[model samples]
Target: MEEIDKTFREAVADGRIHGAVLIAKDLTGKVDFSRSYGVRSLREEDPEKRPPMVADTPMRVASCSKFLTSIMVLKCVEMGLANLNGGLEKLLPEVAGLKVLTGFDDAGNPIEREPKSPVLLNSGLCYTLTFPLLQQYRKWQGLEIEQGYDNLDQNFKYPLLFDPGTKWAYGPSLDWCSRVIKRASGLSAEEFLQEHIVEPLGIDSDNMTFELQKHPNMQARRGDMTFRGGHTFTAESSSPGTGVLQYRDEEYWHEDIEPHGGQGIYTSPESYAKVLWSILSNDGKLLKPETRELLFKRALTLEAEKSFDEYCEQFKAFVPGVPVPAEIKHSHSLGGMLTLEDCDGDRWRQEGNLSWSGLPNIMWNIDKRAGMCTIWAFHMKPWGDPICIELGTKFEKAAFMMLKQ
Candidate 1:
């Protein structure tokens, strides 16, 4: 733990990271280590004014929010409110009528046509929308559209990159899934999640809510957002490989949106760890054993798996800072990215581990086989910046060694 702490402090001192929260818990729901390091915001020059990074500091977990969304959707299934294999179009008619984006026209506008088949709920949960589709949605649905269920419904009018079930793409499928959960359960996604998951688990409401209201004690932390330089790192020279790049300043937190099923979560590392523990414990209180298995089991088809692999390769290249072990094969599960094998001879996560991260460099890995779950969180961007990934990897390695001891 000391080494891990030192690594975080060094990164902060060197201006690689602003602050971070790290947590590791073992099989029996016992926390092995939970700590925070660095200042909450580098922008605050006054040491007295800046908040010290603490375990309870709230962070926008970015895509990691998908895990909570998935759990709530699964809970809907457990309660007979929704079906896993049901047609997404049934809940949201916009999904059934989505088109496929073939290419762009002379004016640089998208050209789309009808899809060969309708997308199923199962496929929608795992696949994401293409960039063109998002752009098309903004074009058609109006830029003033808010990011809520209605906005998602309107965005569903955009084209699909591929026939939904034919290939897997990472997009806003879970966001749509959140919409489905809302329709099927007859409750707002946020309310349903609170009633069914957060309150039941005794998790802090402030840590899990979708509302963007600022809290006196739980305000979202600001990221460092600096640029790294080759010879001399300057704010303007910040590249993905270089210094921190701040995306959201303090003002960004004031803007609010409806609970995004895919990425709109604000939580602390300690609060989120409890959700992981529930899965590792397999207590049958939140989900049945069979349902829990669905989370780690390979949920993608052979063709879909191929598509996922290709996308990941491109994704790795796009974000050079994030490291993916070459020996590891990945498949999509209902919960998140599923590891098919131990890439580094089980030096860290075991095979069948469920892992994913948020856009701001927050990461988590649930190694059910090892009865361990670890989370590393910080509010920094561009996602997968090398410094943040290295810190996370170092912490993971240290955690595994501590477990062995």
Candidate 2:
């Protein structure tokens, strides 16, 4: 493990990973080991070195916040607070007015759709925020958004490409789920998380919110991501395809916005590792196996007829992330993307394996075969290096490797 850790640090030492933390847990919830690498912040605010990336230091964990929202939503479902099959028109009458923008008709004219199905409570459980619908909704009602959250929007008030179940778009759908969580449980996203997920699980509080006080080294920074073919993805707030290169827009930091369930939370390697430990074991203290099993199962699978329309078209409107292959078993669990096969970079689908990552770069993997899991994290990317991904793959493989040994 020491050798693995040393190699991981070396792989990212070129300042690509700024800092990182890793946690390995066996099936029984026993943490085999924990460690932190690099300084607390690249800015290194302290004259002294970073405190070990332990359970305490809050890390900006991007979209990892979705998993917590997933849990809260699931809890509401388990308690029979919300029905999984009802459409959005029923659950959220406000969205009854959304329209669909299918590219164009045969004559290169715009095609407007009346939506085959309304968004559903379960659909919101999956993050499928889209752009055309966002804009259209705002126009329909003269809407204006305050935060990247809750029932109101200058951004999300538009129509959707397809009604809820038909399309699959990746986004702040957690924002929608946040609304469902509030409606179903009579609790806000933050409150539901604190009461049900965080407090009960004994999770550290700092890593759960967005907009922490700026720390020199650890603060997230925006960066330019030059993809495969000279395509550069850039944004300070939210990229359509790629995630937070850095997340410090004044509006983002200052507003008393609703929880940015997609990318607002913070975490340290140690604290998130504990979450992995809890989920992997079901803790007997948190969720029963039945509830956890539901969490692992696919809440949503990409529909064969409209895969591209859902992922590449509507969802990737701006950032432009590639569509995961059909062979790649990607499911929408409350915890975000679930893997059914081993996704070693280009291919991330692992058969019967359920897992996902937080924004920038934080991953949680559960191998059903191994009946074990691991957790890992780093601040943000676009550091002119791919060390975080590189190191994560290495350490994750190493952790799994040791189990066989």
Candidate 3:
């Protein structure tokens, strides 16, 4: 444990990361190790003037939000409010009639068409819908460039890339799932989480809130974003794909629309670790044993798994700064990525371990077999930056080694 702590502190000292919070725990809910390093934000003019990072420091967990969203949807399933195999047409009527984006025409306009089959609620959670939604939201807000998408109706009107359940593409499908939860439960996503997950778990409300602006305490503790360029950090926000410089304006922190289920939640490492611990222990207090089992089990079919692998391969080139390891064999579960087999040399996670990462380098994993769950969070941009990858890998290796002792 001491050695793992040393490695993390050294990484911050060496300027590899702005700051990070890590939490590792055993099956009994005892914390095996936990630590925070560096500043909460490098946006300050003087590095020495920055606030110190702490366990309770709030951060946008990015796609890590998917895990919570998935659980809530499953909770609705448990309450008999939803069907896993049901098609979206009945649950989310707006999305049921939507088309998919096929390709671009000679004029560089999107070629859209209808899907051959309906999108199941189960498969919808794993697909990508965020980018198109964002584009549409900007248009609805009256932004001129890239305008025209109005609501869920227009945002999801693109043609399907492939039949749903046949393949997987990462998108805003979970956000739509959140919408379904809202409709079925008669509560907002934030309200449902507060009444169910947050309150029941005894987690601090400020620690895991959907509304950062409403929670002033969390806002004060929010970490600033950084990129890989220098030892010194800047407060500027950059668009995910395009290198366009943008401010972390009102839209960045607060959305007038319903909370995004896929990527909008903000939380701390300690707060989220509690949720993971519950899964590792398989306590029936929240989800039944059978439902918990589904989270770590392989949910993708053989054909879909192959498609996911190819999709990941194409995405690797777009990310700069780090090389994504190709040795890891993975399958998708309802909760996150399930490790199918051990990599040739990489043993960061045991086989059957469920893991996933957020867009800003935040990552977490639950290794039920190993009696451990872990999270690594840093407010950094360009998700696949090599520095973040290397730091995260080092942290995992150190954690497993500590467990062995």
Candidate 4:
């Protein structure tokens, strides 16, 4: 792993990234390695004064939260708290009633129509409410919503991009699923996750939480949020694509409503590793064998897989850093992206491996065939930052090579 360390250090020295935490473990327990590089916050110029980024430094993992949330939802399914194939009519009435947003009219009104199919429990995608009608509705209602389950009824007022089960589009479907978990278990999403997932895995609350503001220890250890020059959410920099890492004064983690099941998580690579490890090792402490199989198996229909393939091809333009081979086919698992073929010509992940990423250039993999799982976290943006890609590719290849040895 010397090359991996050297590449990461070089990137930090060159201002390509702020900091990162990488952890790779295998079921055989032969190759266990982890490393933390660079300072957590660049606010302090003096190296001695800056807090060092560690494996447990709390990070707003963004969409990587979905992987954990998906597992929790499945756990609910195993415990009879959720039904994977059930319709959303009872579990989520608002989502169930959502209409299709076909287009607009002469007066600029959103065109709507009832969906031909019912929205099932599995019709989830990472979506944001940017539609004109939905925005107007929220503004008219004076909703001061942040990212949480309380905002779901208001947020999903927008029309579905396509009928559920017809095609795939990334939206707030998982966020709604979180609501289902809550209603079925008769507990808040956070409470259920803590009792079932967190406590069983032996992770400390300080290391993983939905409310970063409440945990001062995690708040203090939180890393700075950095973004590419043209990519900061607040404003576009005059000089974009300069590869400059600018600090953003924004908080993606939230404390309001039930914890977002899709993307509201504050956690560390080490803490999350336990969750991934539990799945990778097939340990019943987290899920049943049948339920765990759901994470690695493909769950998409032929039509959905075709749509998912097109989306992946388009996603490549955004994800320039990953070394996924072009020939590898992708299908959605119950948890995340599952490969139908060996990745990187068998040099990295084998067939049936599951993988996904977050907005801040975080990537994770769970390879049951290889008995290994890995997470590489860099809290910086423009989702597919090249520096992150380079480091992640190196780190993933190195981990796979270690397993081969």
Candidate 5:
């Protein structure tokens, strides 16, 4: 652990890692150890400069929020507020008649549009909002929109990419799911999540909600040519990558939608570790143990091999089927990108490990096989460059070694 910590610190000192929170848990999913590294800002420093890199500073841990959002939705499922196949129609009356987008033409135009038939509740959980989903979603935002949510209204030609069950193109699915939960539970997504998951787990805003309000400023970072070659920072929120970005600053939190529920979450090593424990433990607080099992299990598709290639070129996710239960097959689980296979063959191959990475390079991996969850976060530019790969792999090996001990 010392060697791992030293290298991680050295990387931060050398401008290799931006900011991170790292944790390694035992087989029971208890985070026996957790550590955070680096400052939220990535600026270079001089001898007289005061630099801060620590666990106290809050951060907007992008896509990692998906698990929390998903869990909150599932809790609704457990409480009988939502059925796996029923939420869409109940949440959005207009969505029942939506035309799923198929593709865009040569000029970047949506090409195919057809009525989405027999949609699954999980599909809406992924970001399939119709006028009803959007209109009812206002409860989550607390503002009545003159119009409903649409990535691009009247862009039916933008197409559905592929039939819902036939492919996995990650987009605004989770946002739509948030709306579904809001409509079904008759509570704003934030309030519902707080009452059911956040408060129960003791998770708080920690200024992340505040930062998002400032949008384009709060949670903003500037790129550079180097430590000395200054770069003009951009003022914008809403990450295009993985659709997991948010535009919020201190002022944004004041708004009803500050938490945004999509990503703007300020998490810590201990807090996030608790979430990993809940999901893996299935302790009956968040979701039933069996429900948690289904989450980690593959939810890809029947023809994932053939269709996924068409949807994405990188990572190339595959459903290898379930290794946990005879009746369960993990082949369809889309919990997290299988960005990692093995840390060096000396460690686990990352199978059955549900996890995600924050833009600042905070990465987590869960090994259901060992009931262990490891998270490492760092603030650095080019978030997922080779530096993260090497360090992330080393971190995984170290965590596994800790469990072995």
Candidate 6:
């Protein structure tokens, strides 16, 4: 824990990040480490007004929302309100009706045909917004997507990259899952989370929500989002950063946007840590034992696994921290990526453990073997900021070492 503190302190002192929160806890609750470092905003001129970072500082957790959404969807399964394996046609006709893109026709028009298979609940490639056709169509339609769900219609209009369940492609499929939860349970995504997940876990309602603006307490404590100038993965020679901090939209999306299952949730690291610990410990507080097992189970087909592997290999060049080691055997879990066996690196990650990252350099690890989970929270541009990754790696290594003791 002291090592983690030193790592973050040095990072702050060197101007690598403005503020960050780190939390790690084990199944037995014997090892609980939670701390925050640096200031929330460097721009605040008044010393008293400028707040020091804390465990409850709100952050727009980006794709980390996927992991949280997965939990809510699993709860729906426990209540018999949703089925994890069933086709999504009934729940979300827009997603089900999407065609598969074959290629382009003459005159550069896109060619699409009916899908060869049904889009299952776990099919990550069913409907993606990243496809060229989708992007073209979005531009053509003048689509203004401020929220994850706002892209639903455009996603429906676009073609699927491949037949559903045949390959893995990260997209708004989980956001569509939010729609499924809404239709089946008769509640907005935000309300469902508040009533079931947040309340039962004893997390402060204000600390977790899709609409941060409405929660004045949490919004007031919200940290500023910053980015390193001239530092991007695509650059020919990427440096950690130029040391000049440029600010991004602190509130990334419009406040009026609907709650997206894939992204846009504002939550505190301390609050999120509780959710991960519940899954890691299988505490039966948020989900039943059999139901919680889904998070660790491999949900990818052989063909899909191959595509996922290739994607990971190419993705490694873009980010310093690789969630899935390209050389290691891996597969997609119901919630996130699952390593097929133990991996030795800065730290030892166990087989079948689930993990993922947020867009703004946030990362989480849920290790069942070590009976522990860890989350590193930072608000920065470009998903894999080198400074955040380096310190995050060190923090993880320290946590595992502490577990050994």
lDDT of 1 by residue, 1-405 (tens): 888878788877776776788989887544489988877665566666767877766777768888888888888898898887766656878776667777778786777887676677667322222354455546554653333333555444455777766777777777777788888999998888778777877887877766647444456453333223322111223355663334234433776665668887777777788888888888765688988888988888888888777767765633211355743677878898887877565567878888877766778888987789988887666565667677889898888777666
- lDDT of each structure? 0.70, 0.55, 0.70, 0.75, 0.51, 0.75
Residues 1-405, candidate 6: write the lDDT tens digits.
Answer: 776788788888877787788888887766789988988765565646768989988888878999889988998999998887777778988777777777666766667788888876677353332355556545545654222334445434455778887777776778777788899899989999898889989998889998776788886778777677644332333655455765556434346466668786888888999899888877799889998898998988899888777766766644323644678877888788888878874256888778987877888889888888999887776666667777887787788778777
Please give, for residues 1-405, the per-residue lDDT of candidate 4 as tens digits. Answer: 898899889888887777899999998886698999988787776768978899998888877888888888888888887787877778888777877766667776667788888877777333543334455444444654334335666555455767788776566777777788888889777877788788999999888777677788887888888777757331233443355666666634434455777777888889988998988888898889998888877788889888777765765544322456645777888788878888766578888888887777788988888888999988887766665777888898899898777
- Number of clashes recorded per candidate: 12, 29, 15, 5, 43, 0
* Superior by TM-score: candidate 1 or candidate 6: 6
Model 3: residue 176 alpha-carbon error in angstroms = 0.9
In candidate 1, stretches whose alpha carbon ends up further than 4 angstroms from where it belongs are 28-31, 104-111, 124-150, 153-156, 214-217, 220-238, 244-252, 317-322
Candidate 6: residue pairs that collide: none
Candidate 4 residue 108 C-alpha distance from true site, Å: 1.4
For model 5, the superposed segments whose C-alpha errors exceed 4 Å read 28-31, 42-51, 93-96, 102-111, 124-158, 207-261, 309-334, 337-346
lDDT of 5: 0.51
Name the candidate, 3 or 5, with the larger lDDT value.
3
TM-score of each: 0.87, 0.74, 0.84, 0.90, 0.71, 0.91
> Relative to the unseen true structure, what is the C-alpha lDDT of residue 214 in candidate 4, on a scale of 0 to 100?
76
Model 6: lDDT equals: 0.75
Clashes of 2: 29
The superposed Cα distance between candidate 2 and the true structure at residue 244, in angstroms, equals 17
> Which of 4 and 5 is ahead in TM-score?
4
What is candidate 6's TM-score against the reference? 0.91
What is residue 94's positional error in candidate 6, in angstroms?
Answer: 0.8
